[model samples]
Target: MTASSTTTPALAKEVALLAVLATLWGASYTFIRIGVETIPPITFIAARTLIAGGLLVAIIKMRGLSLPKDPAIWKRFFIQACINSVIPFTLIAWAEQTVNAGLATILNSTTPIFAFLLTVLITRHEAVTMRKLLGTIAGVIGISLIIGMEAFQGVGKELVAQLAIVAATISYAAAAIFGRGFKGLDPMMPAAGSMICGAVILIPVSLVVDQPWTIAPSADSLLALLGLSVFSTALAFVIYFRLIHTLGSVSTTSQAYLRVPIGVGIGVIFLGETLASTALTGLVFVVIGVAAMTFPSRKKTVPV
Candidate 1:
């Protein structure tokens, strides 16, 4: 078979995986919203990580894959767990108490913009380009547009909640950069280990703050939690890592753009939510910014 012919099927599979991963993550916001109606934030996040961690462990065992035993790697896993899972999950859950899940997902799409800026300003790992700079500015403007002036008048708590989601997105950006440290390790191991570590960290907090044993969650809430853990957390990671490995970071990160429409659709259909025209416009801007930042640059050919 020709190299080009062989590459086509692989690329198609990766695209399909990307679509599925986006859908899973999009559904996560909806599930979190449903779950947090009865389950407290800390307890909900704790359950999500613990359940997902257990499932990943089972998968690893079934596949005969072993996790790394290095203490340093474990330490990194803890750090990633905090930024990637524990902190963000808690913040999003809290934010969802006030913010709509669809809008939160739209705001969260700014992750790549934050990632690019962090790489330029903090990490100095990537050179700052005009395109990326413009995209970053556009994303901020988009967020402002999403949160219209009317939302701020006597709605400080709501604004703060929305900002919490932005903070969560920033944390996600940092995690994406930090995750590069695990390049040599099995991709699944970091995801599984970070989730386990996240659960460990959140357990004490949930016990103290939430005291989940006293609460009886509704059937819908319980089902939402299950879906979040299994579909969004565990299966999504499997597809995510596969796409990252196959398509490279730029293409994989494009899922952020795809997630917006899926999230908005699910929220509108399932929750009977309505979005303002301004919010939709802002979503377009955010998607455009993310696309600009993540789309691969073309190389110019020199005439021989």
Candidate 2:
């Protein structure tokens, strides 16, 4: 087969996988909102990580893949778990108590912005370019539009919740950079190991703070929790790794751009949520900014 013909089908498949991954992650916000209505944030996150971690373990065993036994590697997994899963999941759940799912997804899409800033400032992995600088400014403006002047007027709990979600996105960015240490390992191992570590950290906190044993969650909440773990966490990770391998990191990360609209659609149809005109406009700018940040730039070739 010609190179063009072969590349076309592969690209199409990757695009399809990207859409599916985006939908799965986008629906996660809606599920978390449903779950947090009855479940405490700590307990909900604990259950999510444990369930998802268990599913990954099963997959690993079924595939006859063995996880690394090095203590240093496990430690890295612990750090990654705290940053990527435990912190972010708990924050998002808490935030959703006051913030709507759609808006939360919009803010969470700022992960790439945080990632870029972290790379340039802390890691020095990439240099700041004009396109990236403009993208970062656009993201800031978009966030301001979404939050609006009204959010600052009252110093309300809602404003704090929104900030917490932003903090979570920053943690996610840090995790992305930190995760590079596991470049040689099987992707499933890091995913499964980190989730397992997250469960360990969260379970005790949930018991102490939430006393989850004392609370009887509703059927809907339980189902939502199940969906969050099985579909969003477990299945999504599988698809994510496949995309990273097949489409490369830049193409895979572009899934963040698709997630906002899918999340907004799910929130509106199922949760009866609505976005303000400004927030909708903000969403557009945020998507464009993130696209600029993550979409790989083409190298200009000078005539030899």
Best by TM-score: 2
Model 2 worst lDDT run, 10 consecutive residues: 147-156
What's the distance in Å from true for residue 219, model 1? Answer: 0.7
Candidate 2 segments exceeding 4 Å error: 299-304
- Give lDDT: candidate 1, residue 206: 93
The lDDT values for all models are: 0.92, 0.93
Give the 10-residue window scoring lowest on summed lDDT in candidate 1. Answer: 146-155
**The best candidate in terms of lDDT:** 2
Q: Provide TM-scores for the models.
A: 0.96, 0.96
Clashing pairs in 2: none
Writing each residue's lDDT as its tens digit, candidate 1 over 105-202 gives 89999999999989987899888888988888888888989886647585698888988999999999999999989989889999999999999999
